[model samples]
Target chain A: MKSFLSLLIAFVAINTELFAAEAGMPQLDPTYWASQAFWLILVFTILYISISKFYLPKIKDNLDNRENKIKEDLENANKFKEESEAKLKEYDLILENAKKEVLKIHFESKSTLDKDIQSKKESMEKEIEKEILKAQKEISELKKNSISSIQIISGSIVSNIIENISGDKLNESSIKATVEDVSKKNMNKFL
Target chain B: MQQFTVQRIGPEINIVGVDLSFTNASLFMVISAAVIMLFLFLGSKEKKVIPNKLQLIAEMSYTFVAKMISDTAGSKARPYFPFIFSLFMFVLFCNMVGMLPYSFTVTSHIIVTLIMALFIFIAVTIIGFIKHGFKYLSIFVPSGVPAVLLPLITIIEIISYLSRPVSLSVRLFANMMAGHTMLKVFGGFVVSLGILGGWLPLSFSVALTGLEILVAFLQAYVFAILTCIYLNDALNLHH
Candidate 1:
């Protein structure tokens, strides 16, 4: 502001002297300063108004448009970064879930195998017990028949032996029946 | 009926009695435009790291605007370099051309300055709207003010904001026009003096011319920097 004032004063001083010297007669009009001031103010006001209304606005807009474009680009970049981060997080979760699921399947399969092995062993033990019981029952039945045959044959054999040695006692009907029974039983066994 | 009047030096052109005023203003504008184009076209070719004649001028302009945008508006405002740079070049060329003898300064006229200022004003306003939407109106409301003072302060701020174009245009037109008119009157003295006692006005004219050159540069810079500030306002719109 001071510089502007100084320049104005300097210009006036120089022009005043030059105008006076050139005229080769008298001093410049006393109203000269006033006239110049008025015109300067007028011209200045007109220019100020025009520029404020038209040119400045256009120039300002062009500058701002560029800034807005840059800002928009930055915002888009930030959005992309966030999306990528979110996708990465999702992938990590998916990978973790996949690993846990694999572990679960492995454990379930191992338990199932254990149960199958236990059941198979129990069934085999039951089958072996049933076979042992059947063998015992058969053995017992054979013993029962053997006992009866032994009882009858023992009496008959003793009587035969005594008779052959002494040649004294004749064979009784009951003894013969017993000997027949014993011999029959023994023949059946042999057959 | 004594109808005898000697009219010397007829106009170079007259059309339809309206005078077809392609005045000194039009002439200087054309000259400025031509000179600027010539200088720019001849200065650079395909651009070089090591500039040739025209390239040197173009490179200087580019760097000047680049520095201005970065410095005043920060790197965020770098994209406006071309527009601001072009403005400087055009104005500077106009100013320099005006300094030539018998040449009119186009920018010294209110019409041209007003157009330039109006463009910047509108541009900034548009940017503010686009960036902030309706929220940009908040710029009219000061940040730290009482509720009761809001209306009054807001009105002042609005008026001041509206004054941007006027202030910008006036500053340029006033400086350029006032300076040139002064130069012209003194220049006439130098001519009329006929090489005797012409030394006085001649010396003053030379000094004034030098000062005018500086003023030319300063005014263009002021215009451009103010544009950058307005751009900052639009982008941020700080209350």
Candidate 2:
């Protein structure tokens, strides 16, 4: 602040005298000022052109390049996201197929176990049916053989008893009764 | 009150090793430039999404230039946006700086404004020639005119087109010089009068100051917009 004040004071002290000298010196014609203005403008135009060509265009190009880079990055990001989503979809389908294969294997295993159990049950039933038929045939055959023996023994015993009881008459019936009586007494020797 | 006077303050290039120098007006011009730079830099420091007081001023200036470029130059002129923006801001700052209590307006000088206007004139002319080659000369030729009137109409068109720089610079410099001189003269009157007599001139000065502010903004707008129009002539030279 002090330096600025001093500079201002110095400029004031210097310019005041210069202005006095220039003033009251009969003004330069107005047309001269206009001509000076014309030349000054020419100089300014040259400066602006130099600056515009050298400095401004580079600044503008830098700005444009930055904008273009941002746009390109955004586009690339979108494409990458799309590609990743496609890969994700493919992975999901593969995962789903693998699950289905596991389920199919489990179902086939269970059905095979069930088939084995059903076959074992059917063979066991057939064997039991065959054993039951054989046992029935043996029992019937033994009963027939025992019935004939018992009938013959009973006939002889009845004849011997008739003969002992009724001494007098017999005839054909009497012969049977005498035989039965003889079988009962000597029973063994009876004819 | 004491009389104002000028005296030697410093040395420069001289006939006998004495220093050459500047004047009171030149000194004030340097001060004006400094003040303008300070105000603009400070005003922009608090740039916010929603502006504070200083930022509002800065934003208003930005909007002013943007609107001018869009209106006069059209969308094609958008590529030159920053240059036009800087020009408007610089001129506007210089004008407002002059409105301070004891400040001198550098823009009141023909040298300053003529420098500006001349640059625009040359730049636009060069751009026209470059863009359209020799065909740009047809801008001076009147269209659909009778063959007998061709020479007369062509002279009128040439004079009108040639007067652009004069009109552009003079409007700004003359207005600034006239307004300040009037203000100074009226200020002398108010000081010379006492008590009740001073009131009328004081009030008038106040209204004039307000009007001067509006003129200041308008002058800056006119300058920038005219530049845009010239730019359009270069890019698209319409009859």
Question: TM-score per candidate, in order?
Answer: 0.50, 0.54
Best by DockQ: 2
What is the per-residue lDDT of model 1 for residues B160-196, given as tens digits with 9 covering 90 to 100? 9999999998898788877876677677667655565
Residue B31 lDDT, candidate 1, scale 0-100 = 62
- What DockQ results do all the predictions give, each relative to the true complex? 0.01, 0.04
Per-residue C-alpha lDDT of model 1 across residues A72-143, encoded as one tens digit per residue: 989999999999999999999999999999999999999999999999989999999999999988888887
Question: Best by lDDT, which number?
Answer: 1
Q: What is the lDDT of residue A86 in candidate 1?
A: 100
Task: Please write out the lDDT profile of model 2 over residues A144-181, one tens digit for every residue.
Answer: 55444444555555555666797543455555555556
Q: Which stretches of candidate 1 lie over 4 Å from their true place?
A: A1-191, B1-24, B146-148, B189-197
Docking category of candidate 2: incorrect
Chain B vs. true chain B: TM-score for each candidate?
Answer: 0.82, 0.83
